[model samples]
Target: FLFSLQRKSIVAVSFIAAFLCLIIVRLTNEVTFPLILNCFGQTSVKWIPFSNGQRQPLRAHYGYINVKTQEPLQLDCDLCAIVSNSGQMAGQKVGAEIDKSSCIWRMNNAPTKGYEEDVGKRTTVRVVSHTSVPLLLKNPEYFFKETNTTVYVIWGPFRNMRKDGNGIVYNMLKKTVDSYPAAKIYVTTEKRMSYCDAVFKKETGKDR
Candidate 1:
């Protein structure tokens, strides 16, 4: 009877080992961390498509996500997605504040046409009421001069944002003070400088 009991235990252990081996084989896959965006009271996600410059259709997949929401948003077949250069901290501010302001502004205001639109770029949604951003220089009086002479504010003699952003903003002031016809254009980082006819950091209307 004792010998028979030992045999039975051996068989049970072998069966359990085999079951674990099967599970290991089935679960052998690379684990990939997913990117998530928390919005409103739920989580929303969109698939990003890969582009090849040629007029070819892109491919995408619904990234893995977990959230509890009553409604699921329908996704389009296109892969064109916009994201900010900022990191996680900035993203929180964007969703909390920027999104609200942008909603109201778009409803009552019209988007400006004829300006060169940025590719693969996004704007932070503004939320706080009447929290106006001083779009132009500290002193708009100098940046926009009303005179017989045409003074163009050049963009960049500096290239990298860390390396060139301050130089670009500061040199605009220098050009106005020096009374120069051609100012350095700092907008483009193709690492080249050119002349401009009329330039403004941002345009604002009296109505706004």
Candidate 2:
């Protein structure tokens, strides 16, 4: 009986180990496959045949939609440096170093004009929140007209970003585009926002 019990314990341990290995494999695949796909420009977006029987490339980056062209945002970069507005970078003086990256991402309304020594002067992309839209509008010339080359990605709750003529932020963005045709602006799709929330929950074991 003792021998049988010992055998059972060993089997249980082996089973647990196998389960852990499976979980690790799944996690690794989830994290790595998306990156691989992005690197090869084979993201979730797929090519579809047009009405004229011609296949068109529907390029997208994680479900971000370009407001002007009404197509998916197509962007690629070798390296990206995300500059935060946190005070921790006050004396870092990493501006020149950050500027060396192929792409520089900034958060909403974070002005680099005054803090060019710590934050970088160049901005390839700017992720803005719905609440910060008005703040940006306050300086429309600086944010939309001046930085026309920079891509703008906006994120917010569905109510504020919806397109049924009820989304305040969406309407504002539409007006901004009409005002500055050269501005490159994109908004996160509802599905993409849900996916981000799912990822956050999966990683932290808590709802985002």
Candidate 3:
């Protein structure tokens, strides 16, 4: 009789544990989906003009150049191609095919000058990594001043792009724009960056 009772107790405990697990899973699903849905594929935030609290000095020798607000690209094209920095495309001979697309997006500091036969010479947008900012700054005059029409979207951590005056990369980019006066560089907003982190955490169930 005691053995039978112990068996019933074990079965009861197992049933309760499973029931709790199911409830926890249901609750997590309910909360996780709403938060992640808002961040799905969000790469940048709106470019509203920064207030005094959010703005900082460009620290130019001539004068300060304030970061201007701008809107995201409103492409009306039906076909778009995202070109990644992959070595497989080194000799793919797809330059003509890539150029045929209505719009193109490139990642990081991938150049099209030498690899035009494989990656095409046209670039609608280049999504730059934060680490490449310093490199671009080295030749800011040539890259930003000379090519004033190329649009660049840079993404990085909060410390690199923050407006609290401590953002090293942000200040450097501001200086570049101040000198060039016509360079087009867009830094991802903090909100979008946080949302991206949240999405990553939710998907991985760990902090990014």
Write down the lDDT of every candidate, Cα atoms only.
0.30, 0.83, 0.68
Q: Determine which window of 10 residues in candidate 2 has minimal summed lDDT.
A: 23-32
Model 1 spans > 4 angstroms off: 29-92, 95-208
Deviation in Å, model 1, residue 11 alpha carbon: 0.3
**Candidate with maximal TM-score:** 2
lDDT for 92 in candidate 1 is: 43
- Model 2 Cα lDDT, one tens digit per residue, 138-202: 99999989446999999988899999999999999999999999999999999999998899899
What's every prediction's RMSD, in angstroms?
A: 20.4, 13.6, 16.5
Q: How well does model 1 score by local distance difference test?
A: 0.30
Off by over 4 Å in 3: 1-66, 70-77, 204-206
Per-residue lDDT tens digits for candidate 3, residues 9-59, read: 999999999867754553343223333334543222222234324422221
Q: With candidate 3 superimposed using the best TM-score fit, by how many Å does residue 2's alpha carbon deviate from the native?
A: 99
Q: Which candidate number would show the highest lDDT if scored against the true structure?
A: 2
- Which whole-number lDDT from 0 to 100 does residue 24 have in model 2? 53
Per residue, candidate 1 scores C-alpha lDDT tens digits across 38-148 of 322223332232232323221221221111111222223332223333333232433333322311211101121221132111222111111111243344453334431
